[model samples]
Target chain A: MTTTEAPAPVRTAPGGPPAAVRAVRRWGFLLRRLGFYAAAAAAAIVLNFLLPRLMPGDPSSAIVEELQRVSGQQVPPETLESIRAIFGDPDQNLGEQFLAYLGQLARFDLGVSVVNFPVPVSELVLQALPWTLLLVGTTTVLAFVLGTGLGVIAGWKAGSRLDSILTPLTAFLSSVPYFWVALLALWVFGFVLGWFPLSGGYDANLAEGFNLPFLASVMHYGALPAATIVFSAFGGWLLGMRNMTVTTVREDYVLLAQAKGLSRGRVILRYAARNAMLPSFTGFAMALGGVIGGALLTETVFSYPGIGYLLFESLNKRDYPMMQGVFLIVTLATLLANLLADSLYVVLDPRIREQG
Target chain B: MVTQIMSDTDHDDAGTTAARGADGDVLRVTGLTVEYVTDGDPVRACADVTFTLRRGEILGVAGESGSGKSTLITALTRLQRPPAVTTAGSIVFQPRDGGAAVDLVTASPRALRALRWTSLSIVLQSAMDALNPVMRLGAQFADALRTHDRSLGNDAAWARAAELLATVGISGDRARSYPHELSGGMRQRASIALALACGPELVVMDEPTTAVDVVMQRQILAQVLRLRRTLGFAVVFVTHDLSLLLELADRIAIMYAGRIVELGTASELYDDPRHPYTRGLRDSFPPLRAPLRRLTGIPGTPPDLRRPPSGCPFHPRCAARFEGCDTHLPELVTKGGHAVACRLHDPTQRPQPAPGTSTGGAR
Candidate 1:
């Protein structure tokens, strides 16, 4: 029988560069990605201007009708004319209005919140954003860490007692509506149990200062809402991470790690869990985008002055400017979160680094 | 079973001496049977398979994809999963410490884990999935060494890993490279070096060179051969290519339907195959002596082991069929050192009427 002989080794092309140069190149790649995001943001602004024109009614006329209904009396012809003069010319073409809207956006003048009487939409949104971030951001991070850790354990020991117990429970929780769970938590933790405050940002009698009691009162009022968010959202994280971990545990690299005789814990944690966590990281990043939205019903039910509650109030009173501002911020946040997730894919998985 | 030949000591006795011969018999397996429960039915993957390997010997076990060759090697390492039951077997691994033969099939989980990479290790089939995409080659090697020997610090582990990579013909710098950065051949070599990090006595390779191109396959084979010579580790090389096996293996075992139909020295098996199935296999392989020669593929696929034929697994494919071949099963009988299970080779066995002829006079 004839045998094939070993082939001559092909000489590798010479490489030139130190670690510092490679680091700079990687940063350059990141900047190019940021450039794409800036382009998307510009397109979003243009769409915002064009979208209002597509609507059937004239926004200025709608405002006049709303003012008359709220006052419960028809305004005199002179006052109506004055109102029209300040708002805009009623007979102006839609093209002019659209161009004027674009001009306003260029100056960051989103206009006033009609429901709030005199507050600018941007100012109102900014006041509410920090509360939403505190409530949602903290809960999201906590859920992600707890859920991902449990998921890794469940997947590594799949079909064991731990998986048998956690899988069905998390699946049940995932199917339960978030609003229903929030309501239940409010009833149990807030009203019936009386362990936490029922509503508002802080205890009514607490002094507004950077003191321990004031901070404690703020945390107490925030507890039930935060718990509602965490409990309702944790199931999704757990189920998602568990599923991903199960898939990653079966990967050949994990088997190779086992073959290498690495400690069981190291194999599970480093090889299996780390790879399995990739999909969960994307989910977490997407959740981070929704932090600005918070939990609308929960926030409203608890009277928390977060962005979700403010957005709810704005929608009720037809506060178009405030609603638009909140929508733009939420949309931008979502897009940014997605972009971050994509960039992280390159960091977590080397296969994407070169291709990306 | 202690053999007289294995009892005598030599300078090569750096490990187990169960199957040690002057020619280097390092591992011996006998009566190995592996069955798996599939859909609540026990499917026999390997049945009564047996073979031996000398130090520095590559014993190629040739078969089609499902012929249980891969299953056999996996069973040798106890890597087979649940439902794939290793029902009955004795994989006597000759240890490197010159200790008594250890039965791999019956070893405890702890014992098996300890023996892995230190005494017997496996090089898996797929190179793409073998190395962790997240970890660098050096880290992976260090992980292997650190697993077995905890005293190895990070610096020491990395140094040892670099040395192992260098031994496998890879540069020390390549150790820092992640698996994705390396080529397919490089990945396979890195995997091989990882397997050999502890300098195991026997390395069980399952389709180790199949993933690479033909040229790369040769390079990997040559590297394995060179390492075997320098380290004196035995190998149980499993592959589907008989021609490659003929070149690489000192002895070869031909498996058919989960059983070893023929086992002999590579040259002897190639020159004169006693079993009809072995003959068919030898004839089917593309003849290298004549480049223009048409390769003949075997006529039928291997029989399903779940519902194997009663008399002989190879009866349907065998060219020489006789009466009683359908009624009696052949037992593996020894002729000198070689073993074959064919009724035609028996002295008392009588030839029956040829096919399509009357059986009145022959009976």
Candidate 2:
């Protein structure tokens, strides 16, 4: 029915400002996101400073006791004093100790490792970081890419036999403990089949370089652990992506895309999978952050020289400084990854850019 | 087959009327039955529905909620998802290129894709949800444009996209913005522009203006009318608002349950509704110019398609019930320009018009 009221004026400008001002407004969201990440990192650093101090036992005495147990010789008082200074002076107030800790962090001086007396905690961490990053990081990216691709297909043809087979299979694989799968993979591929090295990151006797033999040996050592991680981890990505793709496929935009006469591939990939992958990005970022810590149980089982193994060794040795260094690194890495995800999301979803 | 009601006198444009009379059968849906296959039994959502759309014609399908209006739209476009399947009938769409008419129900996936955008497109209800939130408006338009024409360069396609936006009164620069950037009304208009990107012959709209405010609704409908005048695409607009259809559509089909109960020219349905249900719907809306009156909504909710009422589906709610009303189903019988499915209008049952004799049904 015709109305007496005149039609309202159309929204000509999306914003009130002219082009230059509007262009400046676009960067406001990114600046705000950076501010959030910086705040989170500050909070994480404060917590890192406070945690070890709050623990009951002094790390110095623990080191002294361990030294006596190992050598059967009484440790000197000066040694204890030096260890206390290296850890954090028990004499100073929490405020002064916190300031000192921050200073050390700023200088990248994480103190000496208790397990290997004069070796710096940062040096130990640096040595182990690359192995874990190469192993777990590569596997995580591989699993995500392959799993998401299969998921898009499976979800697009949800009722087909391919979907029918993969859906239950992934459901089962993802639910089983990955460590158990790692053990099984070790028994089958390493122990029984003798195809891969049973333990370690690379051949101990190989001359370390970017040479062909060393790289091949590294791959040879990494293959069993990588396969096990991918086998167990891929299922989760596939299931998450499949579920999301199934839901996204039902979205009005996806339906409209189909109605637009787009090819089936276009509908599945650009329309369905593109939106579906948004939720998975957060998960993938967290997984990337965990890559810095490495897959703990899998690393222990493989006897790989990674951050996870180093942390496990530090825990057994009661090496507080090493553990604290690893924890700080892990926390910072997680924050950085989350920041990356948020920025990536702004690129992927334009709605986020408008909220600011 | 239900009778095709093309009221030559109802059209204001002489050129359109002449073109329709020459060769206007763009879409002929014959006995199109759609059913939802549930666990217990298959529920018939659209049972034996038949209608024909002429070139450049606007056929408005008006019904209450759960009246299978949406179901018919999806079925006609062959966009029905799982559980809902077209078990019978054919949607014989004749392309404007003078190609052979192809039945959509039996068409291959490749054939369906070819028809989309170029020959037949859809403008869905919620523009916010219908547009790709991640993609820019211009990119989505370019996608459809480049897809149909492989020879179109990327820059040219984008230029064409901006031009399409301009048709809907959206500025060329706004096409760079995302769907969320534009207001609700603008997004709906953008979707309309997208649907007309390939110059489709038939545009199936399912309550395209339901989500917007009254002012925006009027603006969008007005824009649709303006565009249809120039592009000349047939629209099958489905909505629950009969009064809106009375103003917009050339021919209005009123659906009750899962079937078209009455269909006629907009004026014919308004001035003299043949079926009792259509009369109830017409009276439900408050007249724009008339004095104040109590609105009389049709009694009883729509029947459940899972276990629909026997005989005439509307008989249980009928104000003019007589012998054989509950026992026998009525067929859609056309008298002059109007077609109605009711025992009261069935000449075979009544033999003659009964005046002031049996029931309290309003004339």
Candidate 3:
């Protein structure tokens, strides 16, 4: 028998040259994804316009009646007519009003808050935005990194004493309801021990100057709320990351890495941990959108000047403008967060980019 | 009974030299028994299995899915978990520097870790799941090399990895590509390259080509043979295909119901199988040259190892069974370098023909 020196390379259907062809394919795919996002955003905006109309009561009449109840005085007919004209007469044609609302959205003018007297919805929302960002954003990022690191250690040494200790603790913490945990924390840290202030945004005694003392008081006031946010949310991240790491450890690639004689630490971190992070990464992005809207009940309980507290107040006062403003911001933020995640998918996994 | 026939044959070659060619045996496994404690019952997966693999030779272990072929290889590497127990047996590996052979079965975890990759390695089945999609291939390779050898610099580690990739028929440039960027064949080749990065003396491959296309399978097999020639490492090749083994392996062992029924040179097992199970496997593969011929499957499924037959495990599926076949288990007997486990060839035991057939019809 004759043994050939080299075998011929396998060939398949022509798909053009590799480099230039793959680049063009990638851009084409990204364009398609962008188109899908644009379509979805348009649909959401349309739904936003239609939603308020479907509400049971007339928003204009509700605003007027609420104002009268607060003032405890009879308003002149001329003044009431002027308020109606400015807010949009309830009797106007639905199609014309819808067109007018769309025009206002295009110009970035969400109009005024009907519930909060004389306060523009945009100004109120912006004021609350920074607080939520500082509280939840910092905690979420910290939780992701710390939880993932711990999870890698736990999963790699699975069935050992460390894993045995951590697994059940994380499970218990994850099962505890966030609100229940917050209430318990408030009772202990606030009412019982008096280590932290029970409620409110900043210390009432601090002067309105950008001084070190004022900043310190602000941080002091933030301590309880920030702790509550981290305590309630940290468990979810830890449990998610730990479970994912366990599953990733069983994957064939991880076994292959171990068989390659990679050091135990390197195998756990570079191979197992990175792959395990994929599922948790997507979850974290979704959580980012929710965080922007802030924790509604938590903020209400604390009397914090975050978007959630603002939304609660606006709902109680029948503040239509403030409510519409907050909802629009939330919708946009969620869509943008999802868009960021999809783009991240391309960066983290080149296969998605190549498949384009 | 078969032992008598073997001793009779051994007497004819008493003066042959055995020592000069004996040093090349890299791994020798004898009487290996493995069982699993399943739902409070011990299920035997391997029993009294014996085989030897020499350096620079490929030994193919052929069997169906439930034949305990994978368990045998996994046991050799000490990769089996708790429920699966290695009850008895010794897996001895002859060191490359002529040191004392180490028994793998009883080695400590630390000793096993040190011996792995440099002395022994394994290649798994699926290429897709056998690579970290998030990491660049170069970093993955360097991670493996860095584990055992700390003296090598970053550049040198990468250089060595690229060289190893070339050895597996992949280009050095492909080292920078992630696993997902590579084709299925390329990914398998990369995995094989990683297995050989530390220059292991023995590599256990379990169905490495099972997931690839037919053409890619042949390419991979050819590449493996070529690497074996250059590296001179011993291999324990496990697969379900007997025909492919004919071209790649020097020796072949057939397993049935968690036991080695026959062991011989590739040619001997293919041309003159003595065990009924081996004969069935041989008859099942269609001749390569006759493409249109119908492939014949074995008549019955393998016995469930949890509650195996009393005597020979293959007796239920064997066409050559006689009256007393169910009463006794046969010991493996060596004859002219081939080992077979059967009772018909002994002079001490009465040679009763099978119930419905004559001796001539059996052959």
Stretches of candidate 1 off by over 4 Å are: A1-29, A49-110, A208-210, B1-25, B99-101, B290-295, B350-363
Tens-place lDDT digits, model 3, residues B1-363:
001111122222211112324467787676789999778679889997777778877989999999999888779888776678999867777777876666787776676677888889988878878888888888878877877898878888889889988887788877777776777888888888988888899999988998889998998898899998889888889999998888888888888888887888899987788887777787787777644555556688878887899888877877777766787787777777787777764435536544555222223
Name the runs in model 2 displaced over 4 angstroms.
A1-26, A51-86, A90-99, B1-22, B290-294, B351-362
Stretches of candidate 3 off by over 4 Å are A1-17, A42-110, A113-117, A145-173, A207-220, A354-356, B1-22, B151-163, B289-297, B345-362
Worst 10 residues of 3 chain A by lDDT: A8-17
Provide the overall lDDT of each model, using Cα atoms, as 2-decimal numbers: 0.76, 0.84, 0.76
TM-score of model 3 relative to the true fold? 0.84
Give per-residue CA lDDT, model 1, range A83-168, as digits (tens): 33324545867567656666665655666566664456678888898888888889889888887888878877788899999989
DockQ of 3: 0.31
Worst 10 residues of 2 chain B by lDDT: B10-19
Question: How well is each residue in A137-232 modelled by candidate 2, as lDDT tens digits?
Answer: 999999999888888888888989999999999999889988889999999989999999899999989999999999999999999999988888
Weakest 10 consecutive residues of candidate 2 chain A by summed lDDT: A8-17
Full-model lDDT, candidate 3: 0.76
* Collision pairs in model 1: B14-B96, B15-B95, B15-B96, B15-B97, B15-B98, B16-B95, B16-B96, B24-B54, B24-B55, B25-B54
Interface RMSD of each: 3.5, 2.8, 4.0
